[model samples]
Target: MYRINPPGVYAHESAMTEPRLRARVERVAAALAPPRVPVVFTDEQLPELIWEGRWTEGLKPMGTLPEVRDPVLVFSTFRFDGKEAERGAWFDQLGTGIGGHLRNALVGGGAFHWFPAGLKEDPYRKEKVCRACWRLHFQVGCLHRCAYCGYGGVLVTMVNVEEYIEHLDRLIERHPWQLTYLLEDDADVLCLEPELGCLGPIIEYFGTLKDRYLIIHTKSANVEWMLPLKHNGNTILVWSLSGPEQSRTLEPKTGTLEERVEAARLCQEAGYTVRYKFKPILPITGWREDGARAVATALTRTRPDVISLCTFMWMECAEMVRRVGRDRFDPHFLAAAEAAADTIGGLRTAPFPEDARAEMYEHYLTEIRRWNETVPVSLSTESPSMWRRFEDRLGMNAANYVCGCGPQSTPWLRQLPCSAWQGVERNDQGLRGTW
Candidate 1:
């Protein structure tokens, strides 16, 4: 029987939480590690999304303009008309069948991942974060658009934040185990927070559950307001940082590296666990030396609990990739990154240059160790080759970290991660993530 929530209220597929069944599904998901960094969906699907107003509506200005703001980010609210209808319908479609049950149990609130289990469990995994984290989002797109960027400029808000909490409560009720929730996957949770006004209510809700937490990753410095909220040491505050050059060229509207670092410090001082993600490391001129200095500054200044490094993979955002001219990229490294391309997980991605990335990873890792040897150092393992190389270099896959929630699942259109992959067989066996 299908249980429906009230109008404008999103529903969970299974009313009764099946821990055993969820465990079965999650075990398979955790065991099957992917070969590349994959999102819940591919950039190829962006066309259909944009046309429906589910993604972007050009770089035009909209919403209540921030009186004290830059002219570039003209728009205040996301042009996500019909998004509620689309997501509501998607939830309805997944409301039936075992597939929906599996999705509900899976990390993405319905998106299935092949390998849910990452590195072996360690007691001191992230210092402050749970090793296993469930990814949740209240919005899509972002307000930050840098030079070598793709999804940052887009900001698609997901209404029904309260309704989603109701569904999440059922997820927790089903399995009342200690777990962490990662917020702001599609957009920075704290960037437009003042307008949305969701942090307090969401934090209060999480506090009710036994051992529940919220992890937010952002580059924006608008975190001062959240410092005073009672988090119970549950929220893991993260900043996606870069050196001065990359920050200036790539991240335009976002604040300076120093500003973001200062925000991390404020959070740290306010009694919150802080972390850093030196991702999509643009290996440009003097990148190694400069990057090392930046890493040194972050480690020495903020002393975050963890530092995860990664290189760029903009293949999914073809439009953005086209917008960024070839001159902006390291041509020599680009060739190598392109050569390492392979179908890892469900998406088709060519990861960052492995050799060049290995060098950059070593530099950041070395610098991080200099100031804070206790802080865990990590490398992004979105690709199989990248994961293998990092594991080989570090002598082990960095245990304490978070991975993508897998390819985007369009439940309204195609609930499966890849509708095309369903017809095919892997190793001549049954389909993966199939009911």
Candidate 2:
């Protein structure tokens, strides 16, 4: 409930008095009123352990369970003067989710990127092969306790929202071909909510832009904060959903299946484009039934513009078992993964054979079609061969498919290619011929 800015912070005193800064700070504090959890502020990016310890101390009263721990929001106000020295510091502060080499590559440049699948010589190229899309990060770390993810325990957010918006405008103007900027693969940004108070401003900023759109990717159900914003149908909300069993066991401290779909329905009704991503779909016992029910819940409840599918594909089989526990996985999949462990060549992820993954994708595709056959369905982070296997059935290929968060995957580009739409401009009347 209280703002915790350490004394003699790196941010100048004038910044505290600046109308925009003060308004953002005060607004977030006010939103988190009747105080339950304390907000910590620091100019320096502290170690992850330090932030975790602070979060534990602040949320001690909430309970000892990881699910009950609402992370202590650390407002990092380290000023970036656009200098080389400070720029290095800025990228360094971008949490563990963004890697060191990637941080170096983004210096003095736009954070929006379509990451390559590495060079032919790269050893991990096979595992890394997937459709590329432009992604951006507003916050770095997460607050949720999903077993597959490492970004948890504390949420460190850069407080220069105005500065970021200004810079983002330039990035959008430069990349006229880019349609949507995914905000955030790193964190479940909305889980910080109205208390964070940054998303509203960012959403509105995208609303003012012409053809540019923002995709808010999250597993959190804290979307009431966005219901009132006039998104101008330029903002898309893609929920990283999972089956009921997986949500209950694997993804702790995140929204329930019903909660996420209901939130999607609300967002759709609010005139924002809504989408879903069954990411890392666990191949547990009764997975087919469970995944089908989840797809049904989403499709019947809310009309998603697109649905992207992804089988569980993170870390090696043994590593996942070690991290999430052996009992958490289905015995059949576990046995298959264990048997195939030594055969893993590229990235040790998705230990299942090609046929197993194809089965999973095909089952979900059938369930999706039962409700809405015409709705665009695509694969997420899948290899070229896998995409080719089902490309005919999906009516989408790796290159031209509408994705959960691709740069050119907006509703306007649903049926048209990016090249076809590029020649047209977005004016008061909208895109020439398309609109």
Candidate 3:
């Protein structure tokens, strides 16, 4: 294992021969080979300029645009069947709304390369092979009517509990020793857990697996049902958080920040490890101070075991833009995302300039690091270089690798050097062990 120093930098000692690296690379290459999907869509198939009645007319720019150029129209696509009643409503609304813009931006500028028909082929599916630390949404639709949330009634949920559990069982069988599993398709696992009666069983099942870890994250404060469960080290509860301004404006349906923090405290007090995800970090005028204070308050209240930080990401989807609207959208947030994207070699070859994004990232990083120390920090859906810079600033290396196993492994591995191989000894005051 590698040893990670303060500020998060990684240094590896064991050198794999070219042949070994080549073989490992080959295996990953084979695993990443795109699977055949029944349905696929590209940007060219969608329309742009929704209700084209002068998009820029009378629209005052909210904030100063970062030095980065605006995004170029790239190809984008949305594929979902409207056959089932529940799913049909979701697809129709999404298609006519945010999905339209996403498709236009992606395909128009040739940004994202592929679009799958359903969530399964979306690559970020919750199964072990495809899932990332970012926690894939499980419920097809969201019930909460948060004004700022892009997903409201846009997705569907699986009504068949046993069948869904069986599907997860199959996934587990394929990767039995998997370290972590994150339920991401929806905001609150308990929101649907009460209806399906699956939370207890899922927790029990994961408990049976000695090495694996499970995390149930939510924005809901309806956690009375979770208070009674027998706690274990492998099971962690995470809560998504926003500042007071955001909670009042964008997330009126979700619990207030105080309530969420109280819930987190309750879980922690119950001996359940908890994680805090401060995502889509909004850029309201006083966001810097408000965001930091919110985080500090949460830390004092919950004393969480881990924390992850992320900014908003803009997809080429039209429905996404329409739902959020340019008015509420902060140019700084977009510029920060663009900067992160640029550092990673521009996921989309669009007009968003990389230099501007880099500056924005620097500003964001400097501001957020001021809140606290000791808690591990990471970005959601960020590029490698962005993370590299973060790690470098934190005096840490990429010792922690995220994916399906990231939630579990990151917390443990982040304690060591990023470059150290498993079983390696470090000179950090006799702290030596496999993380």
Candidate 4:
């Protein structure tokens, strides 16, 4: 019922006072009438909308990473009401289900899968479902068409926002404190905010509960819209980020790296707790230099409450590369990325040769740990057993440390071993816990 205009769309009274500008406003307003109900836009309709446009001109040329072999065509089907809509694609297993499918179909599959597995099986709670922290594409369809993304045909259909709200209301009534109503959906809250305005309402509704935390993760730089909303400590905003190089090369349409940092800084300034996710850390030729520089830049620019660093893995992303064609970019980089994951104990178990994977993991762990000692680091979708093996080597419990929010009470405290912490402190000069 309320109309919230997007920024940079309105005119000043000086212009409005002119008959011509006034008439134009009236015509534009009439043309821009709100739909009777929010309409779901499918992937078919997305291309026509200018918001889905992408720019990828200034990216670096693909380097020599090993090419993906034996690409697997995966179909991620979300079933509701016994009806199914299918999205399928070939991947080399380096991305999430939604992202992989989108890449295979849209961007021609040169990108790697970034989605982590076992998120649906939260190891912490046997009865609880451990959905991945980032669920942007699955829930909302693909909103932003980043240039590297291959999901051009992916459609984001809008479900009835009120209906979903009611569903949550009913669920809460039936099972009090049973659900951690975390909005880990792939669609960012900012993207949905303009349409549903659900944040304030959801917060208000959930505020009545005695137990529950609403986690909203995003990479969007749209912060002004969120500042005015009312939220209690029950909500946490997890932001995914990368260094300037990665941003420039890989993340084409998302907000600039500096803008994302500014957004995180603004959220912290607004008294809202925020978490940092530096996941799928790609291994370029100078990965150590690049990754360390990224972390240092982020640390200096925005002091988030918690930071989580992850190494890159490519189990489900191989198919994407095959679909996109090797000639588009150097397949060697992808192969090398796979090699790096294999070396790092984070490779997927079953069917994969254990001896080769173990050897790769050994080398990968040694390097990543050597660089980032303080921040709590963990693997996603890695077999619990394999993680345990590396956890022993790293001197931490990987099973319990699934989500990279750091520790529960003192999340800001880097969970490195005391010796390693001291080493990091000495090297990361001038770095402090507080902003």
Candidate 5:
């Protein structure tokens, strides 16, 4: 970790009551290089910019600047009425803003709400195929500059974390069937840590729960601060992994593969269940050898309870060409995607054909099984047909399979039977009435 400042140094005294919590916030703030222009908001404007997709209007206030010379940290003071226990400062600052331009933003909103991921239909297949669960966002926006990713530039940190946890607790209580809460679908949350200081309390809060679990998804290796938390084995630390070439060329800003694996091992040793997600698996040149080697290396250090695999799915064939350049993808897959680009339209499925995706998944499965035969592996956000195709090979189907962040996939209940959803209805977490 970058030790920029001494421990527990606060630029300005915050109204946060708890000493330990305040200390954590101060520690994170101290680590960062102070922002040049510290802007604060006290209304729905920032939220609207993030959630309502009104960045053009939002950026109008910042003036027409080609690039940000000094890093800017925006803090939200709204809804923070004079209560000491409910005070915080929301800011976004990574390193110095060198050659950084505000091109686009993918800020996770400041609202505490449930997204019906299972209820959402795939754009390509036009059907509900994902596992039934709720997608929770603690904070929005990522700072990592992955070449293939366009979800950076602005990070919206929910300052009032106590209230966010309360809202989450109520949501979890209302939906008894929703056993797992998957976070970080929209952000690499840990990247904001020490500075954010909310993850620790949230993990401890989940520790007090019964069957409920918290799945924190990230591409960050910022786990030293979390190793001593009272997670009680309720928090599942999931790392979004990539092969050597992908990590090097594609995700240069994020942690290296070895760093992430070592972080997972540390978390696993600290009694937190660890999971690996080969999300957006790029089929670059020599991918099989590199991917298999990455998997073998990870397995050698830590034994993840479950593993999930997903092919590269963000950009279109032409979009990939535009964003990451045409040279990023494998020639074969790129040619096939280009041939089928017209038919695919604006759908968000993987760029490859069904057969190609299956081949990648099959190879990953074989690699995983070579190390651990019984570690529950499943596809992440894949279609029904693809799941069915590999149902036998995966040892579980989409109906009752244990994913990296499914509601019923508590660490204790490792392998749920196919009939696990016997009486419980497959209803969305946001729709409690249907169940």
Candidate 6:
């Protein structure tokens, strides 16, 4: 009964012979425990990183995954997986950990610690750096078919979970400053969590860290497995939110708008500090009202510790749309995105148009902030010009909670700041208020 979706409820009829089902459930639950470590990754054990979509048309089906691990078997029983919403900031953040430096190193980036294998100067040896927020991910790539997502089809699985755990533990033991870590990016951790069989163990592992935050972001409502675990309030479950319309239509394969909110509520009820990411805000026709309603719904559903907001910054996501268009995604939106696409920060994106972006940001921000006045509402700033434009205007802090473009970030050093709003200054309201 501890599980929201109780164990054995979804079991096949053949296994419903009470004792057999119970035994099966017990076995599955037992597997969630952390494996005895010293995870040895031999020369043949290096993880595979494929840069392609898992599915041809929409999101890759869970069936497409090659592995038949026990966790994957547990995952197969679930519909979709954990949290909700959308974010393009991660596209930039993850790109850095994969090869690029983080905000501590790249100003505009966050303090991210990447997998040593990818970041090392030599294969076995590690690169030297001052400090990072540790972009630690046991998983990458997602199966959700959200239109705004860039990391589709190309599913990546991190096979070396025990090894990653070892590396992170060693890093934490050695470097006290590496307190924060982003647990996901390549994929929604919870989406494939059951199959991965790492979520419970990972949360328990991180719980041992004092004053540390392990942020898990997702657009799935597959949280049935999490309720039974003892989190110790160290894990922050974040949903990548979108306008309700966008959530339903654009990101259809992901959980429905309400389902995500409910999932967050479930996590909050279970003692996890839940957060929402209102990023890649698409202010299309009825976006204002839809966005407002969605924000209100989120505030009402979950006790959000913080609400991070960011408008759509296309990056390479638009090209993804061109390559593999979904039914709900509009051609006009893509056309507008293509037309609006340009270099922002170091990344090319379809930034909110100078005229419209300002008003849209002001309108939704004013509305979003109005809902939860006490919770620190953070906004995503991809570039310096972006930083300057949105900076201090909303009264929210620069965010390292997720995007790592907080007050400490300095990506501006390498990339020329965008000057779209050159003459504009934040009025008393922090917005020009002139559309």
Q: Which one wins on lDDT?
A: 2
Candidate 4 C-alpha lDDT tens digits along 244-304: 6666665544566787778877877776667767754544345455556656656676656
List runs of model 5 lying over 4 Å from the truth. 1-29, 34-37, 44-72, 77-110, 120-128, 412-414, 417-435
Which regions of candidate 6 fall more than 4 Å away from where they truly are?
1-132, 316-349, 396-435
Please name the candidate that would achieve the greatest TM-score relative to the true structure. 2
- Sliding window of 10 residues with minimal summed lDDT for model 1: 1-10
Model 2 is weakest, by summed lDDT over 10 consecutive residues, at: 426-435
| Models, CA RMSD each | 14.8, 7.0, 17.6, 14.0, 7.5, 14.2
Instruction: Show how many residue pairs clash in every candidate, following the order shown.
Output: 23, 1, 65, 53, 4, 29
Instruction: Give a tens-digit lDDT track for model 6, residues 1-435.
Output: 112211111222222234533443444444433421112222112111112211222233332233211211111111011110111233334442332221111111111233332122324222111112346544334556555554443333333344345545655555444344666655676765564456777787777778666778788899988877877877777788877787776675677778899999988888877777786677556777888888888887677766666666634434445433434334455455555555322243343344445655677678866776656554454333444566566443222222322212221121113321122221222111011
Provide the overall lDDT of each model, using Cα atoms, as 2-decimal numbers.
0.48, 0.65, 0.44, 0.41, 0.63, 0.48
Native-to-model Cα distance after best TM-score fit, residue 77 in candidate 6, in Å: 23
Checking candidate 5 for backbone clashes, the offending pairs are: 28-194, 108-140, 108-141, 180-407
The TM-score measured for candidate 6 stands at 0.60
CA lDDT of 44 in candidate 2? Answer: 40
TM-score against native, each model: 0.61, 0.80, 0.58, 0.55, 0.78, 0.60
lDDT tens digits, residue span 1-435, model 5: 332211112112231345654554545554566422222233223433333332322222111233312112233211322322122122132211211122111121323334445443423434324555556765444555576654444444445567667656766766687777888665677876756677888899999999889989888888999998988888998888888777877676578899899999999889998989888777787889889988998988999888989887744676666655676667887777788778754555646667777888988988998899888898877777888898888878877777777767777455666443443443334421111
Weakest lDDT window of 10 consecutive positions for candidate 3: 1-10
Candidate 4 residue runs with Cα over 4 Å from true position: 1-139, 147-151, 157-159, 173-179, 314-375, 392-395, 402-435
Give model 1 RMSD, 1 decimal: 14.8
TM value for model 1: 0.61
